[model samples]
Target: MELNYVISITDRDQIQELAALFQSLELNMGLAMLGKGTATSEQLSIYGLSNTEKAIVSTVADGESARQLFRAAKRKLFMDIPGNGIMLTVPIKSVGGGRTLAYLTGNKTPAGGAPDMNFEHELIIAVLNEGYSDAVMDAARTAGAGGGTVLHARGTGTKQAEKFFGVSLAEEKDILYIVATAQQKAAIMTAINKTTGAGTKAGAICFSLPVSQVIGLRKMDDN
Candidate 1:
């Protein structure tokens, strides 16, 4: 009875293949966008990644379905391979308004229960001034982050944001999506704070969402 948000990021060429997999799992309602990874050359070499071009696929899935897709991704997409890709799911606190929620759940009313915050994985989302994704990723790497996907996005409520911060909140914003273990979340957030926090020109705002499940992110054995 729980909803989960599933996100998959992989090489651009694999978009269709992965999408097909999602369709096979009935995760048909989704969107795909192009992005570029911000991994350093050394990092790329370490992960066996050859290109920076990426495709980010996202969908809203029920909890059980999300788990099924996660396992399929590891087996079909080679997600367990160091640099193949990463997928994660965050519990959805609530779905939609009354009717919309019912439709999504096939007439079942949303439990609307209090959200549970305890989790072992976190999704680090950082919104930064344009062109600063590399800087943010640099700090992230120093704090144990493997890599991140950068998406071109524009900010809204510029006036309110600028007034509150007393600085220009550029409409053009770059969003960095980084997933890390719960134990490493604090360090990664700290690193981002020092480099692009409110005091800096990047005007970065960072936060974390408790992830219920993560796939393709486990460290590979040396076997």
Candidate 2:
């Protein structure tokens, strides 16, 4: 059995509906977080998006179930339509312990074999000081990134982080998620690090995760 971490980003108003959809799929252990779209006013206008508030829902599922959830979301929520939302699956490479693995997989037989790492798209996650998202996105765009979703967050281990980095660390943070083609991932990450890295005022750290599948990116693809 192969496992994947599925994430859906949509309007905050759709949280209830999205939760219901997840229930129908028996993905009851899902979690939801509040976020905002990073689209500039012009980009939002071009895409017909008015509301920037978003809800990010995540859950774990087997490979087949993950595909089913994507199909259902497209049909019922019109996620395939531009500006509706986006969904992506990151292949789960391993679990920490047997009990935790069983809990996540509903006690299914322990998964075997390594997950396929070959992928066309990657999820670029950048953690930055709260107000630096705009600057970071600017750098990312210059490297061929299309757009990103921003989630407001708080940092822990602030004292330790500051001690290690030798810089005052801000408690408030912003997490930016950018989906980009594998060919452009390196350039995008490099641009971000060079411009707003930990050494800079943005104090940003960027990384990438292999995405097995992605949906609701037709608009981006069209552009």
Candidate 3:
């Protein structure tokens, strides 16, 4: 089945509520990270941001479930209120390998013949050892990536990840987010992998998600 990534950036105190909401919706796979909003004093005042500390919640859901979750979040989390938060979804091209895919999809693949390719933009996400966001960004920039957002996170492992990736995983993590055109996604990911991949202290894993819409980013001609 096709998947979409639902991301919510909201007040730190509201994270638990959203986590419970996701659980109620049966979207078992989720992650939360700590971050600080990058608004100036004037901007914060304009947006009514009393606090800058933020929690970023991410999860995977089917299209229908994603729509339901977004609607529920807007009402329950007060996302319509200024400075409350923002929610967005990015379509996933594919997820997991053979056996892993089976486990993730419960052995039932979507009836679509094969995944289609009509998206123009992608969100490149890189999760790495803590404090390596700058390094990742530098690498990405060299490969045509522009500015990105960084979030402080912690990783939990059910299995020994060191055995699988040949590098010890760090509980403290940093997630770097870069949005680029589809043509630049591969190059950006390749740069990140080379400098921060398993062999490095960063132990980074990079992936991309299709972006179906963009609002704030400026048009190329405008730049």
Whole-model Cα lDDT of every candidate shown, in order? 0.81, 0.86, 0.72
Q: In model 3, which regions exceed 4 Å deviation?
A: 102-109, 113-149, 153-209, 213-223
Badly placed stretches (over 4 Å) of model 1 are: 106-115, 167-170, 218-223
Question: Which sections of candidate 2 miss by over 4 Å?
Answer: 158-160, 167-170, 219-223
Report the lDDT tens digits of candidate 2 across residue range 1-223: 7899998988898888878887888774789999988888888787677956889999998887888888889899989886788899999888789987777777778657879899999999999988999999999999988788899988774677688885454588899999988999999999999999878999889899999988877444544
TM-score for each candidate, following the candidate numbering: 0.88, 0.91, 0.56
Q: List the residue pairs that clash in candidate 2.
A: none
- Lowest lDDT block of 10, candidate 3: 213-222
lDDT per residue for candidate 3 within 59-142, as digits (tens), equals: 877766777787777678767554566666686667668776555444556655334546788878888888878778888878
How much lDDT does candidate 1 score? 0.81
Against the true structure, candidate 1 reaches a TM-score of: 0.88
Q: Which candidate number maximizes TM-score? A: 2
Instruction: Tell how far residue 137 is off in model 3, in angstroms.
Output: 12
Better of 1 and 2 by TM-score: 2
lDDT (10s digit) by residue, model 1, range 1-223: 6887788888888888878887887664678988888778886677676866988998877766777888888888888676788888888887558776655545654555645779988999998888989888888989989888999887765677677775455578888999988999999999999987877877778999999887777473558
